[model samples]
Target: MTLTFASPDQPAIALHVIDQDARDGWLEAQPPQVQAWVAANGFTGALGQVLLIPGADGAPDRALAGYGTTDRRARVRFPLAAAAEALPEGTYAIASGLPADRAEIEALGWLLTGYAFDRYATQSAAKARLVAPDGVNAARVEIMANAEALIRDLVNTPAADMGPDQLQAAAEALAGEFGAQFEVTRGDALLERNFPMIHAVGRAAEQAPRLIEMTWGTSGPKLTLVGKGVCFDTGGLDLKPAAAMGLMKKDMGGAANVLGLARMIMALDLPLQLRVLIPAVENAVAGNAFRPGDILTSRKGLTVEINNTDAEGRLVLADALALADEGAPDLVISMATLTGAARVAVGADLAPFYTDDDAAAQALSQAAFQAADPVWRMPFHTPYETLIEPGIADLDNAPAGGFAGSITAALFLRRFVENSRYMHFDIYSWQKAKEPGRSKGGLGQGPRALLTALPGMLDL
Candidate 1:
C-alpha cells in the first residue's frame, strides 16, 4: 500500500520517547491529571511499549514511547518505529531523547512499519504516518523507505507473479523513473553475450534467462553493483525439499536489494556513476535442466564443475560479476542468497560479507555499526581458495567437504572479479519473524550498510 506524508513534512502530533529511568523527570513536570492517569494505567516504559495520554477534554493529547532500558541496551533499529505503529493513524512529531543526526533512520523506520504487501488483500485500516523532524532529510527518508518497501514487495511475491521477465520489467520501471539507461539480454542472447553459465542454468525454465542492466550518471567514480536474481530456485535437476522450496520465491532478494540501493542513490543524487546488473533466472527442473555432473564454462572462461544443482546462484552471478569487472569500476560489490551455510552461521538477521580490501572492509564495518545493519566479515583466506578448485574443473560449484560453504562461495566469485575492489555479501533476505521496524518477510541486507559506507568509500 502507498503511504502518505504530510506536505512540507510538518508535525501533526507529539510523540514522546523515554525510558523507565527517565520517565519520572518528564512525568513529574507534566500536569497532575496526565501523570495520575499514566500511573493508574501501570505503564513502565518498556521497549516498544506505547501509551497514549489524554488531554483535559479526554481527547488524545500525545504518545509516550519507550526506548530500551539503560542497563540492557537495545537493537535501536528504528527505535522510534514501534511508536509510529502504535500511535493513532496520523502524522507524529517525535520529542527529544535521541540524537538529531539519527532523525532520518528513525523516521525512515516509522515509514517502513506502515508497509504491507497489499497486492492480494483489501485495506483494513489506515497506517500511522510521521512528520519529518527538524534536520531530517524528509524527502530522502521517504525515498529510501519507499525503495525498501519496493524490495520487500518484489521479494515477497511468488514465482508465478515474479519471474525473470517481471524482475526485468521492475528494473526497467526503476530505470525509467530515474532516467537511467536500461538493457536486457534475454534467452539465447545470453550466449551471444558470452554468458554461457547463466544460459545453461536458466535454459530449462519457461521464462528465458536474462541479464538486467541499468546505468546512470556519467562522471565521478564508477560504482557497479551486481546481484544474483534467481527468481525461484527449485534446485534445478537436483530439486529441493518441500520446505526449502516454500521460500524459494525470495531467492532473488539480492537483486531486489541492489535495485533498492540503486533507487536510493538515484533519489539522493550521489555523485557517482552507477551501474546495476541482475542475472534474472528461475532454476527449474526439465529434461534440459543443467545436470549436476555437467561442467560449464563461465563468461570469464573459467570452467566450473556442477557439484550440485542447488548451488546455482553463483553461476548467474559469476557471469554478471565478470561483465561488471570488465568496466574496471572503482568498486564492485555483489550480493546474493548464495548459501545456507551463511544463514547457519549468522542467522537471518546478520548477513556475512567478504572483502579483500582492508580499507573498504574497515569502512564498511564502521558503517554497519553506525547504520544498525549487521554484517560480519568472513575471511577470503587464500588457504581455503583451493577448496573451490576440484580436480575436474577450475572450480567446484559445491565443494564436497561441505565445510566453509560461504567462504568457498565467496572465493568462487572472487575469481571473476579481476581489477576492482570487490566485496561479496551472502544474505538471507527473508525475515522469518517480525521485528520493530522490519516486517516478517523480504528484507534488504548490506545496502543500508553500503549506503552508510559510500561517502567514505567514494571520498564523497
Candidate 2:
C-alpha cells in the first residue's frame, strides 16, 4: 500500500494544527518573526488552510494546518486530510493543537490521503508523509488504510477486467494471504449445489456464475458476511439506459466492501470465526437472460417472481444469505448496492442499514461516528413485509408501487435467514464528487463502522 508512516528515526518538520478558536492564543506564544510571518500570510485558521514558516536558513522550517471552527468541523470529515494534500513533500510530526480524542481518526485520514488508483492510468502519489501520532494504533491504522485501498481498486476497475472470474481470483488471493480455507462452486455446480437463483440470474452471461466462499479463525463468535457480486449490471432484459449504465462496473461494490472488511478482521486477528460469501455474476442480456415475470426457486425454496429483471442483485444475495444462514452464524450481515431508493433516502454520504436486532443497531450507530464512517439505521419494517409477497409467488423480487423500496428489498432478503441475527446494508458505494481523503470514484461505505462495532456486538 502507498499509505504508510515515515520512519520513526527520520528528521521531521513540526506540524502545528491550529483551530480557529485557538489561533490568536497560539500566535501570542510564538516568536516575533513567527508572529509577523503568520499575520502577513493571512492564516486565520480556516479549514484546510496551510502555511509554511521559514527557518534562519530561509528554508521551510515548520508548517501550520487549520482545523476550522466547531460548526465548520461538523459539516465535513477527514479535515486533516485536506491539509495533508496541500503540504509539500516532507515527513512531519504533530507538534501541538490536535485534540487527543480525535488523534486516531485524524492520523488515519492523513494516511488515506495517500491513496490513488493508479492501475490503468498514471496517477501522482501523495507527497506529504506523517509520523504516526502518539497513542494511535499504527498497525490498525495501516490495516484499515490498506483494506480501503483494496476496495477502491476493485470497484474502480472496468467490468471487462473485474468480472466474476477476476472477483473470484481476488477473494482466493485474500484467503490465501490469511491462510483461510477457500472454496468455490462454479457453473453447473451452482445448480447441483441448490443455488438456483444465482444460476438463473447469471445464465445469460458469457462467464459462468459462481459462489465464492472463504473461512477464517476457528474460535470465538461466528460471523458471516454475504456480499452481492454482480460484476456488471446491464439491467438484463429490463435494460438500463446509457445514462444509468455508465457506472455499472461498480455493481459488485458490495462484494468489494465485504472483502475489505474481512481483510481488516483477519489482519487484526480478531477472535471470531469469520465466513464470507459472494455470489459472483454478470447480469448481461441474451436469449437465456432471466426475463420479467419469470418465477424462480431460491436455495431456501422460496419462489420469487421477477417483476423487473433490473432487480437482480437481490436474487444472487438471497441464495448467498440462505447458505450463510444454514450455518446459523452468531451474526449474518449482507452488504449490497441493491437499491437506488437507499441513495435517494440518505444521498451518497450515508450508508442506510436495516436490522431487527436493537443491540447490533446501537453498537453500529455508536461505532460509525467513532470511525468517521457515517451510517443510518433503517428499520426492517414488519408491516411492509407483505409488499414483497405477491399472490402468485412466495416473494416478489421487485415490489410494485415502490412506496418503501429499500425497506421492501431488505424484507425480501430477510426471508431467507430464519435463525441468525441479521443486518442488511444498502450502500451506494460510489463517491459522486471528490472530498477530503475520499476521491471521486468507487467508494467503500459501512466496512469501517462494522469493523469498529464487531467487538461490542459480539462481546469480544
Candidate 3:
C-alpha cells in the first residue's frame, strides 16, 4: 500500500489524543454538549478506544483517541496505531495532547498501519490517513515506511519467485532507482572468485547461487552491510521436518531488511559510503547438495567442517563478511536469520545483536528507543569461541551440544572480519502474530534502529 500524509493545507478533522489519567480533566475542558456526548458513548480513554463527537449539523466535528495508561501502552510498540486502524476513512491531524517525544513514533506507526501484503490474495488497506504532525519529519518517516514495505514485499514472496536470480533483479532495480552501482557474481563464477563456501551451500539448486553487491555514495566513513540471502532452505542434506520448513520462504529476510536499510540510507542521502553484500542461494537437497561432515574452505581460506548442513546461513555470511573485511570498511554489520537459539533467547519482537564496540552499542540502544524498534544486545562471549573450534577444521559450522548456539554462530562469522569494526545480528525476521503497526508476516528487524544510530555511530 502507498502511504503518504495528507497535504498540509487540506481540510482535516481534529484528533485529540487522550490518556486515561487526563480523561476526566479533558472532559471538563470540553463544551458541556460535547462532554455529554462523550459520556453517552462511554468514552473513558481506555487503550484503543475511539469516539467521535458530532457537530450540530450531525457530522463528525472532532475525534478522540485513547492513549490509555503507561502500562497499557508498554505492551505494544505502536499504541496509537490501534486508533489509526479504527478511524474512519478521512484525513486526520493531531490537534493536541500527544507528547512531543512520542509524536514522531506515533506518526510513523500510523503510516505503517497502511501496509498490507496482497501479492497473491486480495487484502484491504487501512482506510484512515494521517497528516504529518507538527515537529515530525514527514519525508524521513515516509522513507522509512516505503523501505519497510519493500522489505515486507521481498520477504513475503515465496521462494519460487524470490530465488537468487530474482533477488539480483530486485537489488539491481533498487540500484538503478538511486543511480548506484550494482554487480553480481553468479553460478560457477562464485567458485572462480574464491567464494567456495557460498557455492558449496547453493550448488544443488536449479537457480545459480550468487553474490549480490551494490555500492553508493562517494565520501565519508565507509559502511558495509552483509546479509544472509538463503532464499529457501530445505536444510540440504540435514533436512528439516515439514513443520520447520513451512516458513522457509522467509529465509531471505536478512537480505530484504538490508535492502530496506540501503533504501533509507540512499534516499536520506546519508553522508557515508555504503556497500551491500548479499549471498543469495537456495539450500535444496539433491545428489550434488553439500553434506554433513564435509569440510569446505571459505573465501578467507579458513576451513569449515559442516556439522549440520542446515546451518548454511552463517556459511554464506562468512564468505560475504570476509569480502567486506577485505575492504577494511569503517564498520561491517552482518544480519542473518541464522539461529533458533536467538528467537528462544529474546522472543520474536526484539532483534538480538552482538557488538564489541560499546559506543556503537550505546548509540544503537538509544536509537532503538527513539525509533520504537526494540533490540537486545547479545555478547560475543570470547570464552565460547572454543565452542565453534572443532578439531578437524578451523571452525565447526554447527557446534555440537546446541549450547550457546547463537553466540557460537556470531563467533564463527566474526572469525572472517578481523580488520573492520563489526556487529552481527541473529534475527528472527517473522512476526508470528500481528501487532499494532506490524503485520503477522515477514518482518524487518534491526534496520530501523541502525538507520537512527548511523549518524552517531559513524560520527556524521
Best by lDDT: 2
Each model's lDDT comes to 0.87, 0.93, 0.93
| Residue 95's lDDT in candidate 3 | 97
Q: RMSD to the native, candidate 3? A: 0.8
Q: Which ten residues in a row have the lowest lDDT in candidate 3?
A: 1-10
lDDT tens readout by residue for model 3, 124-184: 7678889899999999999999999899999999998999999999999999999999999
Model 1 per-residue lDDT tens digits across residues 1-460:
6544566445466778787688888788988887898899877777777788877788677878777576533655777776666666766677667567667777778778888777887633326766677788777778777878889999999999999999999999999999999999999999997999989989999999999999999988999999889999999888898998999999999999999999989989999999999999999999999998999999999999998999999999999999999989999989899999998888888889999888898999999887777799999988998889899889999998889999999999999998899999999988888776788889888888898899998897
Candidate 3 residue pairs in clash (backbone atoms < 3 Å) = none
lDDT of 2 by residue, 1-460 (tens): 5578887799999999999989999999999999999999999988889999999999889999999999988877788888888888999999998998999889888888898888877886568999999888999999999899999999999999999999999999999999999999999999999999999999899999999999999999999999999999999999999999999999999999999999999999999999999999999999989999999999999999999999999999999999999999999999999999998899999999999899989999999999999999998889998889898999999988978899999999999999999999999999888777888798889999999999999999
Give me the overall lDDT of model 1.
Answer: 0.87
Off by over 4 Å in 1: 8-11, 71-73, 123-126
| Model 1 alpha-carbon miss at residue 104, Å | 2.6
Measured with C-alpha atoms, the lDDT of residue 373 in candidate 3 is 85
Candidate 2 lDDT for residue 40: 99
